[model samples]
Target: MTPPTPAIVTQSAVRPLPRWALLLLCIAYVVPGFVGRDPWKSADVTAFGYMLELAQQRTPWLAPLLGGMAPETEGLLPYWLGAWAIQITPSWLLSPEMAVRVPFAALLVITLMATWYGVYYLARSPGAQPVAFAFGGEANPPDYARAIADGALLALIACLGLAQLSHEVTSYLVQLSCTALLFFAVAAMPHRTVAPAIALVVGMLGLTLAGAPALATLLGVGSVVLVVLAPGSSTDRRLPWTLALAAITVVAALVAWKLDLWRWRIVGANSGGKEWQSLARLLLWFGWPAWPLALWTLWRWRKQIFSRQGHRHLLLPLWFSAVSIAATLTTQPADRALLLGLPALAALAAFALPTLRRSVGALIDWFTLLFFTVSALAIWVIWIAMQTGVPAKPAANVAKLAPGFVPQFSALALVVALAATAGWCVLVWWRASRDRAPIWKSLVLPAGGAALGWVLLMTLWLPLLDYARSYGPQVRAVQAVLGADPGCVQTVGLSRAQVAALQYHGNLTLERAGLQDECNWLVADMESWPASERMVNAARWERMAVVPRPTDKNDHLLVFRRAAR
Candidate 1:
């Protein structure tokens, strides 16, 4: 027998957020950090380096390399996508940086779209729906689903973890997109639409191509089981798309293995005692508001959740979250692995909306209002201090952190920030005074506030962030030391960020310095002088110059010239 409905929502609570408002929020969230930002250090720069190589035909398509180092074994598809975007984009219309971002930006949008649709389908399930009123004034199932979907989307946007990573030009975003697509496919399995089947195929294949074959396999298998075992499932009784889903995943897994696409980062990246503690901390805060409500959803619906009927609604997201957490624990940097689960967390959070007591909802509203309002105020104050030197403290802190950062005023940016702030105010006022609002009302402010803060940062603090994160400052230092007509440089233990900077900013070709490789100059950190000596014929090369990044004393490059080789 089907479990009784766990939701206790009413018709009045199913009010839909305005379409225009939702559209504007998404535009505001996705557009920033895309324009006017250089590729940041570490993984972002390293990935861009490979993409540039592929686009310029400097590296073969099958194998990508950055500064002569092998391409990332875990992610080849993201590089290919970015490279193709760069090659196809017209140089006159957009810069190489901006051109590459076009597709990654779309991937983030795809992620959001999948999430909205995923929750829409899941919330439509019989077990997921709210109770019918005795007086015959209950919510329409479809309308209730739409309202919950809106809340899920807002929760996703408000997530602190998604702020920086979603905007980044990285493979992680591609994984996240596919994860959401898988969610959409699984959630919509019972519906009579071609969308779910197509999503199933694309989602499975996309995850494999994106260098997450293991997760793809797990999610695909779990989804099939989730569909087939769902009690009272209309699809389970008459049709068996679950088997089709299983078949699709099997093909995806085989294709990945056949192509040798699966990578092994878990071998040496296992978590230790401290690392486990750190992972726990990451899990607690990464998804923030979503995690708390997700826990609430599990507790409130614990009995129904494991039951056949409720499993349809709860387990799909739970499986996704479980696999993502597993991936997070196993991966070297957990953030990227953790990104794949945000959509699932948001979906689970959406279920908690109906069960929320009035007091609980009020508390959520008050906390979100205070938190975001304060954050927006701080961002505005910092921008003012940086621009006018009124308070002097925040400006001093900026100088201390990002020395030599000269803050500039942009009228357009300021206008955008002011508009978003105004929007937040209107949303707040509407929430506070209005008595009868939708179930999703509590989250509206938090989402808008998060977007407002992001806009402020991208506008007012972009320069300072670029100063700290970009390798331009050090790249300039390296070039200054090289003087004119510097020969090809052989690198000894140069990090990916440094290598990418030398290739992009300095337009210098780099190779590994070894007995087999012949080059005139060597570049590496001075601290590694002894190691650098081992790579080249030290007797034949003399010290050339030491170039130091002005802001960071430890960041200096030791250059060596071949002794008339």
Candidate 2:
């Protein structure tokens, strides 16, 4: 006998979150980080560099490179997308930096949409439906499913980790979006055929091209098994679809192999106690409220989860989440690996809403209110300190941390920040005073608060963050040292990001140190100097300046003026 579902909900509890509000929240979350920012640090800039290379026709499209080096992660599709965006966009409309981010922002939006639909379809499953009432006042299936899907979308936005990583122009975001598409495709299988089939193909192929061939293969294989064994699906009927999917999976793997994208990256065995502890900490904070809710969902829906007759609602998300968790444990970049699982985890979290007690919901609301309120307050206080220096400590701390940074006040930024803060206030009021009983009410504060903080940071703190995080300052310093027309500079031991920064910010022609070139200046990395020093004739070069990144004291670039000859 199938165990009874724990959800006991009336029509009132299934009240829909307003479409306008939901769309507004999504817009606020998706637009900020992508709009006005420099590509920060190792991953963002390195990826942008390849895109720029491709855009300028400086590197081969099939095999993108930066300063004669291939990308660290063998993903080609993201770079291609970015390059296409850059090439197609008019300079008057958007800068190359902003242009490259356009597609990625769309991907994040796609991830959100796919997650919502995935949860909606999963909730519509017969096993996942709320228990029917004898008196016949139960929530309508469509209404209940919509409410749950809204809650899942809110849960995804509420995840602390998604704000930053999803905004970056990297393969991870592509992989994440593709993963969500795959989740939706699988969940929507029983209802829709054409859309699901197209989604499956795109998702599998996207993952394979986005430096995650192994993950693509694993997810595809698992999904094929699920299709075959799905309780409601007949094996005979599903066989053709299963065979097609399996063949696509094999083709994806073969495509990866042909493109030379397969690389063995399993590094979990090397982790010690500290690494495990760090990963545990990451899980606790990164997944945030969603992780706890997912646990609750498993407990509440245990019977459905472990049923002999497979429950697609419980099993599909569980499989996706399990695979993501496994990848997180085994992969080199655990956070990016884990990002792929968030949509599934959010779906699981949404189901917990139907079973949550009023007290538990209240507790969640209160916690989110407190956490985000304090965080927003801190951001405002810091911005004030930066502008007026009324609070001396925060300003002093900023100066101490980011040496040589000049704080500039922007009226536009202030207006945007104030407006976002005011919107948050309105949202809080609507949640506390006007609205109650909606299943997604518990998550309103969390999602709103998250969007509030992100918008505030992107507006008020964007300049400071850009200075501290971006390599432009360092590159400018290097350029100042080089002066006008420092032609054909030779570079030794600079990382891909550093090279890209020089290329983009300084607009300098760079050649490798060993390359046959008549170059007047050579730049080298502080850390790589010792290894490369033996190859260069120290007598032939005079050290000019050690230009250091303002935020990092140890990261220095050594500029050398070739000895006058």
Candidate 3:
């Protein structure tokens, strides 16, 4: 009753890629953003702020409080991990914020490794393997699977969304890593003996603690349903995954209960027209090349995907992607929510490889090569403009965008950019001239190019990005206005990010502005001036100055001084 698999691959089609090349690709993707940057605005600094606070023992670890307000995300483990990393880090080595990045960077690496192994295991399944040739010359199972796994990792690295968030020291990073681990565990369940069981329970529990209890539950339920409904597998073989799911459910409940992460955060209707449009854009660009291929896999493998057979190779990833898509629909900033699905998406994308024609692969290669070559050239040109001002336009754009920025030259940044460019050229040359036709060949350039762009940004444009994204300048400007030893600041209408910055960067104690609280200086956002005055009393406060982040003109930081009696 099961539909026959469409794959008809041969030995030549799935040659093993070099292991060293894969290692280099992963390093290129993982290492750049971890070093040499301040925590950029919004979530990055906000999360780092909480971690720094915990490291300083400023608040209870269970409920991290910043400027008398808890972080908006309802998760403790991520903050706890970052705080622990800070504590463990030797003071002689790096700043607490940078120290926290080390552990999360490891989590990113783990996510990549887990995704690779997951796809590898899934590809080893009987249905997933290519058809054996009549003369015994079909692609060797191990080599084919390894090649496909290689493609999956490349697909994951090539995704535009993975670069920034994967490097972040945040709860959601932990959530994403857990999702990848779940992918591995699910794929490895039938193949492995003990490791998959442990990974499943741990991954589910980790996801629950990392501010995504709903997503964790959905994943767990989906896995359970697939295993139960799968037609071919006997109950004995399915028992382990079922038990694993049940264990995940129980542990996840405990995590949600203990951590207080369970809350109704689904905002408004599931989606409106505007929301759908935003999501469409996110899906189109965020998943990029992977989305198109995943669609291809779903369409081309429809019989295998939907058939009653225990076609878990297709079913598992589809289930994961479907659940994540549903989760994305219901969440705000759907892109972040959609990030959880990417590892699965990448795996789905890899399956499209065996089915793709020679023409299609070459087309992909041509597009990737041209797109990334142009992109790398643009970054180099902008860097030159910023430094030497030969073109004048990029410099003008930089100045116009980030006011008060003084461009400083770094030989090391320049050297790294040059090396990345050189590596890109070599890669392109090899791809063009070489006669090799590995299944992962088309994706190699795309992943390498994505990594190249990120490394270039991190190295060459880090200062500009830091100035534009960081709250340091605004905080310092406020500090100057407040003067040395200015005492506690009473604040109103400030975002969590601003409050965190003031506490960490300015090193000033903050009191939430109110009618009863008395403080020498008050800081507030301009829009809330009337309410701030009403709360802290209009008669006692005098306006000092308005400070804005260099790039954003609309958002103003207002400072006030209290009058003497």
Highest lDDT: which candidate? Answer: 2
- The deviation in Å at residue 551 for candidate 2 is 0.7
User: Could you give candidate 2's per-residue lDDT for residues 482-542 as a string of tens digits?
Assistant: 9989988988899999999999999999998863457889999998884454457767889
Off by over 4 Å in 2: 234-237, 269-272, 531-534
Q: Which structure is stronger by lDDT: 1 or 2?
A: 2
| Model 3 spans with C-alpha error above 4 angstroms | 229-235, 269-272, 516-518, 532-534
Ten-residue segment with the worst summed lDDT in candidate 3? 267-276
TM-score of every model versus the real structure = 0.94, 0.98, 0.96
User: Who wins the TM-score comparison?
Assistant: 2
The lDDT per prediction is 0.83, 0.91, 0.86
Instruction: Tell me the tens digit of each residue's lDDT in model 1 across 248-358.
Output: 989998989887887767834435688778889999889988889999989988888767454677888888988888888878678888989999999889889888888
Clash counts for all predictions: 0, 0, 0
Rank the models by lDDT, top first: 2, 3, 1
RMSD of each: 2.2, 1.3, 1.7
Q: Is candidate 2 or candidate 3 better by TM-score?
A: 2
Clashing pairs in 2: none
lDDT of 3 by residue, 373-411 (tens): 899889889988988996899999998999899988999
Clashes of 2: 0
Pairs in steric clash, model 3 = none
Give the clashing pairs for model 1.
Answer: none
Candidate 2 all-Cα RMSD? 1.3
